[model samples]
Target: MVSAELLKILVCPSCKGDLEYDVNADTLTCMGKHCPECGMPVNRDGKCADKECGKISKNFVGLRYRVEDDIPIMLIYEAEKIPLAG
Candidate 1:
């Protein structure tokens, strides 16, 4: 459980993208762009938009960080990858 102030200042360490906090899941997810066609996760440079989604566009992927005892584990290596594959 992170305070609103803390959550606002938190960003994805990997991509430097904004993070969305999930209260129920007690996690912080990165709001990075993805392939709008196939829904594969995209890189910060807008490359590697999944080999399937030939079209370069936008989707959403998340790097989820868990929170324990009200402390958020914001380490990039510890974050979980969540791809919105269509």
Candidate 2:
């Protein structure tokens, strides 16, 4: 339940990428996709969908942050790196 203003400025510390906030779910998802070298879709499971590039997506590639008590835990170490729909 972070304020819209705070959410607007928040970015992933690992990748410096955009984050999608689900208000009802109270989750923050890093909007990073694909491998820079392979150019394949990074699945919700944080793995490259391409069989050739069967690698786990980078640390910032999934739903990793959570909002608790109206505050977002933006720390990368505390981030819950779990698969979630973008």
Candidate 3:
């Protein structure tokens, strides 16, 4: 579980947005809540509720979290870069 204190320190590089703790993924996430660039939800499913993705970026449309065995695969170059909503 990610501590709220740690989540308080995360930010979105693309938009200088504030990030929140994504409970389901246990990863930090930016609160674009809605993608300003694409004007869509960052998640493929278009959800803005408690359930969110923690990956730093999502430059693609159909790609999901690149986790293995419940572990996050935080690949720098492969990370998806989503346009932030903030």
Overall lDDT per candidate, in order of appearance: 0.68, 0.68, 0.41
Residue-wise C-alpha lDDT for candidate 3, range 1-86, written one tens digit per residue = 64556445544443345555457765544445443333234455443222334333334222122334544433333434444432
- As a whole number from 0 to 100, the lDDT of residue 57 in candidate 2 is 55
- TM-score of every prediction relative to native: 0.63, 0.59, 0.35
Identify the candidate with maximal TM-score: 1
Worst 10 residues of 1 by lDDT: 33-42
User: Where is model 3 more than 4 Å wrong at Cα?
Assistant: 31-78, 81-86
* Model 2 alpha-carbon miss at residue 17, Å: 0.4
Which has the better lDDT: candidate 1, or candidate 3? Answer: 1
Residues 1-86 of candidate 1: C-alpha lDDT, one tens digit per residue = 79998887887765667888889999888756644433345676556445655565444555778999988987755767676564
Per-residue lDDT tens digits of candidate 2, residues 1-86? 88999988998765667888888898887856544334345667767666876788554235468888998887765776654344
Q: Which residue pairs of candidate 2 clash? A: none
- Candidate 1: list runs displaced more than 4 Å: 33-61
TM-score for model 3? 0.35
Q: Give the count of colliding residue pairs in each prediction.
A: 0, 0, 7
lDDT of 3 at 65: 25
Clashes of 1: 0
